[model samples]
Target: MKKSYPFLVLVFFSSCWSYSQSIATSPYSLYGLGSLYESNFGLTAALGTAGIALPSEEFINNKNAASLVNIPANNFFFEIGGTGIQSSFEDNVRKENRNNFQFSHMAFAFPITARSAFNLSLMPYSSSSFKISGLKIPIIDGNNEYYYLNVIGTGGLNNLDLSYAYRLNNKLSLALSASVLFGNTTDERTYSISSSTTSIDKKVNYSGIRPILSSQYKMTSSLTFGLNVKSPTRINANKVQSVTVENGSGSSFLETDKKSDIDDFYLPLDIGVGISKSFKNKFNVTLDYEKSYWDSTNQSDMYASFSDQEKFSFGLSYQKAKTARNYFNRIKYAMGAHYDTGYLEIDNKKIDDKNLSVGVSLPLDHLSSSLYISYTYGSKGQITNSLIQENYHKLTLNLNLDGIWFVRKKLE
Candidate 1:
């Protein structure tokens, strides 16, 4: 196992580099910071992304930082994951298909003491990738005839997180986390009329810090409750703009443009609560509710308005005895569902989303690690009100690696 670590690390880094360019291709990503990336890791992803109150000794729990306290002393845990998505978009008159593959996240957790633990991770916070074209409209002022418009956007935000967890008592734990969010986004718009073309390029860079607090309480031997809160933050942002023109003869020229500071973008507060119950190590159920106060931020972009958002998720799993020698008996099977009232409001219509998922975890190397795979089918938006409907299928693969570090060997 030790000999394979280096090879695995090499593969991980190479995959990360290859997919760093774009993580999403949905047209809906054109709004806001793009489609927000899911923070769930492999185990939680298999459970329908609803593991806030689920405690584990073998896997890192990302939903609630406080759960890190459950890590065994001197043990180190690591995970690397990726996702592939195939999506279809349809309107009243047309349909389009798109696909994307990218690295999801990389993280590690280790115990500091019997009752304390720490974790560090890097993952995408959001993503934006889209292209749209509008019908030609007559331009009265231009010497040309009718012209059509095309818009394209690409880029996204990334997050680096550090967290600490401490057990307060036998039944309670608390945690704190700090996250750095930074990224750059580019938008390009072009107009073509009478064989001549003009385009505007806009780029924005932003960075910010957000703090999170989390806690967990063991209500009973088989049940746990969890809560988390994220504070609002202001992101410093700057924009640079340029324009270019192309003649009918295919000659093109660029004009130096302006750079300016923009108003600080405000992110809203978020809160979540969850509960999990286990049935004698054979069955488990978890439920979670989360809310974001986007309306409280009172912020709106040029094309869309922000509204309060709510999400609900439920997950169930069945696991056989790990002590069983049969490989199939030790496997875990899970299924889950999710619903969200999204944060974006366009043309007075609210964009909503729903999904269903199922997954399995396969033990590897005597259970020291595991391979998790899940599939999700979902839909977003509505065809009415000039909005497009998006139907998507997503597949996730996660490799969890575990090892003991800093443990003193007993002298013979």
Candidate 2:
């Protein structure tokens, strides 16, 4: 096999010197990215929500672990993708933004004797960030006064994950993943009133570890079952700092001197099922169903404990291995849809989540080479009894490249 030495060196050194910049963050971290098996986004989430499974075959296939046992040695897979989001408040205000570039995934699989094999991968775990700002004026007394308020929020929950999988047999396999969570958040709020100006800023930083277990089984020629459990984690936000300033002197009135209490919680769990069948004419179809337990997560406050979220998805595809048509006719076409009942915990209130998505995958001449892309639109259902509810929408695109560098000869 011919190794991409330059790419390998780049990948290695980059990993070694990876630094945690304390300047920014994202809102997507609340829900896991690469949470779903495919690179496609969920109907409700720009890049799909956590818990969805992918195929587990020779391709480093997503779900169905048992399939990994059949994969050949010296296999490598790489994926890259991004998501864009547009948020709207009430019906008049519009907010649009995009997340940072992400390294979707990279994996290596090797043979252990004949029946068993091992696989390892590096992928993203979660990402989250959001900012809301508005101007407000208040009257403190009967006298004519001028006051302006500005609020800003910044941070993203990001995770780095490492995983290993062992195929027990042709029909079953087990996999485990260890993830290190790292990120920080900063909130800036300023109020200018009449002759005085006040500013408040808060920053929180955290580090922790989490784990995931997975299992897959093939029930028949057309049906497969998969399960994943994300262990709980106790993240230590040791640095919850705050600063307050008054007037034009630029002097500090108050500042935090110590860290806040440590917080810990479960990461939630997912269950999924898949079906793949072939038709007489060589056509193929695959479908997926998955469920997530957001309710199991520990809330930070009463408002945050209001409701839990759930998701559902479906995908279909058509492939022509060999056709009499032109070159493009040999490719495969696919589309999918995803839905979610948005999870919530606002002032002990529950909110609804709904979304829709579609995507496609194209195969290359070498079979392993392929391209994929998907997009989604959704909203956080009406907040009960509220004057107005908020809505959110997003788009996502992904590209994948994989191929065998060397193959063992049949008669070697």
Model 2 CA deviation exceeding 4 Å by range: 1-58, 61-70, 85-126, 134-149, 191-196, 248-250, 256-262, 269-298, 322-326, 347-349, 383-395, 405-412
lDDT of 1 by residue, 27-107 (tens): 557667777887678667756689878877767788898999988777788999999888777666567666778899999
Candidate with top TM-score is 1
Could you estimate the TM-score for every candidate?
Answer: 0.89, 0.71
Where is the poorest 10-residue window by lDDT in model 1? 1-10
Q: Which stretches of candidate 1 lie over 4 Å from their true place?
A: 1-20, 133-146, 193-196, 245-257
Tens-digit lDDT track of model 2 for 326-360: 65765655555556555543333444556665555
In candidate 2, residue 276 scores what lDDT?
Answer: 54
| lDDT top scorer | 1
Q: Which pairs of residues collide in model 1?
A: none
**Candidate 2 structure, TM-score to reference:** 0.71
What are the Cα lDDT values of the candidates? 0.81, 0.48
